[model samples]
Target: MNKENIFSMASESVINSDDKLALEALEMAKSKNIDLMELLSGGFSAGIREMGEKYASGEVFVPELLMAARIMKIITAEIEELMETSDMPKKAKLVIGTVKGDVHDIGKGIVCSIVKSNGIEVYDLGREVPPQTFIDKAEEVGADFIGSSALLTTTMVNQKEIERLLVEQGLKDKYKTLVGGAPATKRWAEKIGAYAYCEDASDTVETILKWVNEREALKEMV
Candidate 1:
């Protein structure tokens, strides 16, 4: 099969959440020595992006998303192992999400992917997530951070609401809060009491690890 067909096939498998098809296409890419990163950024990512849209629209369930994420993980694992820079040590747990009223998760998905790629344990709450959901899941899992995204000015208010609840509930000191999106700025993060604000996946991953490591070191010192 031609390279274009292979790319298309890779995307279809992920969009459909067909494990067999995804694995087959990945194997084909491996054998043909195709650029796996191109396959991911071009085809597989395209498929995951469609799935993200469906998820945000309520057309797909979180389980379906888990399947898609797993497929991408399988693909990225092989690619990561071959790369020069190795993956980070998995040490921190984060509740990642998009705040309520925002149905866009494209940026959230990328951030989650990057965090997972860097070996952080991310419990993605998906798009349009309620504030309580973030707290509940983090508490249940004992996560170290509350990572949030708000693509709209309206929904960004929820970030402050979370901060308020954390203080009201006396849980403010328990978890670090991270916020981001198109309209999210460092100033806004400061105003809302978010620990940090990241502009993109790369920045998010880096900051999260740094914060987690610093916290870990402090813990060790005490």
Candidate 2:
């Protein structure tokens, strides 16, 4: 199969939650010398992302979404060994989590997968993470970026607390802060003094890649 076809099949496998097709797509990708990470981000991850949207719109139920997530985890595990052997240098480190008071995590999990596939080292702190925990994890990992997700308006206020803590600790300028979730907006990010507002998993990857590239260019110039 051609690369596009392989990618499409991979995506469909996740969307349909078909393990057989997913494994076939993985084999095809290997035969075609396709980059597994690219297939994961462009194909499998894309499928899960669509599944997320379906869940959000109530077009699909929790079981279907969970099944798709299961398929994603399977495919991710299959390729993880290969991905780890890659010689590519890590571009940056990111600490990510769902803010405290929000137990929703499927969306944030997708963001972590996409971002990590793009060469960023991701430290996933899981759901119901306190703002102080976010800062602590970022500092522990010496992360370049800190990302928080809030699925509820009440929980999104915790994102602001993350920003406040950064400033209060005099670490505001030390790391880039990114905010996202269903209730998070550009205005909210601005009001919280966050560096960027991500609309989705893909946007989060793109924004972080842009920042990594800019930082690399600056280092080269210096």
Candidate 3:
């Protein structure tokens, strides 16, 4: 199959929540010697992006998004594991988790998978994560970005605390912060001193890629 054809099929697989089609694309990529990077950039990304768009438009609910995430996880993991053994360095490093007081895992899991598929190394800290835990894990994993999710208005406050703790530790410049969840917005991110605000898993991946790619370009220049 052609690249665009596979891309469309892969995307439709996620939209339709078809795990078999998703896996088929993975096998086709390997069989045809098509680069996994190309497959992810085209196929995997297209799928997750559609899910994000639907969620943003209120055309789909959290359950639908979670289902798509579950389907995409397989392909992303396959590509991520394949790339790890190669000479390609990870596009970026991320430490991700749900903020304290927010026990939801669906959104956080989706974002983590999307980011990982895009070639970023993600260390997911799981749900109900403390603000301090984000900072600590980032340090341990040498993460370039810290992402925290909050599903409630009250829990969202912890995202700010993460930024505050980063400043207190004199590490604000060392790591960029990203906050997301249903209630999060660009204004909130700005007020909280975050580097970016992501509306969904796809947005999170896009923003992280922008920064990671820029950093890579700068390093290449030097």
Number of backbone-clashing residue pairs for each candidate, in the order shown:
0, 0, 0
In model 2, the worst 10-residue window by lDDT is 80-89
Considering lDDT, where higher is better, how would the candidates rank from best to worst? 2, 1, 3
- Stretch of 10 with least lDDT, candidate 1: 78-87
RMSD of 1: 6.8
- Identify the leading candidate in terms of TM-score: 2
Residue pairs in candidate 3 whose N, alpha carbon or C atoms collide under 3 angstroms: none
Q: What is the lDDT of candidate 3?
A: 0.82
The TM-score obtained by model 1 is 0.63
Q: How many backbone clashes does candidate 2 have?
A: 0
Q: Give the TM-score of candidate 2.
A: 0.75
Residue 194, model 2: lDDT of 99
Off by over 4 Å in 3: 1-88
Q: Can you give the TM-score per candidate against the true fold?
A: 0.63, 0.75, 0.64
Candidate 1 global lDDT: 0.82
Q: How should the candidates be ordered by TM-score, best one leading?
A: 2, 3, 1
Q: Candidate 2 lDDT, tens digit per residue, 1-222?
A: 689899899989999999999999999999889977678878887898788798889999989988998888888778765555346678889999999988877667767766776788889999999899999998898999999999887889999999999999999999999999878999999998999999977788899999888988999999
| Deviating ranges (above 4 Å) for candidate 1 | 1-89, 219-222
Residue-by-residue lDDT tens digits, candidate 1, 66-132: 8887777676665555542335666789998999999767567667666777778889988888898
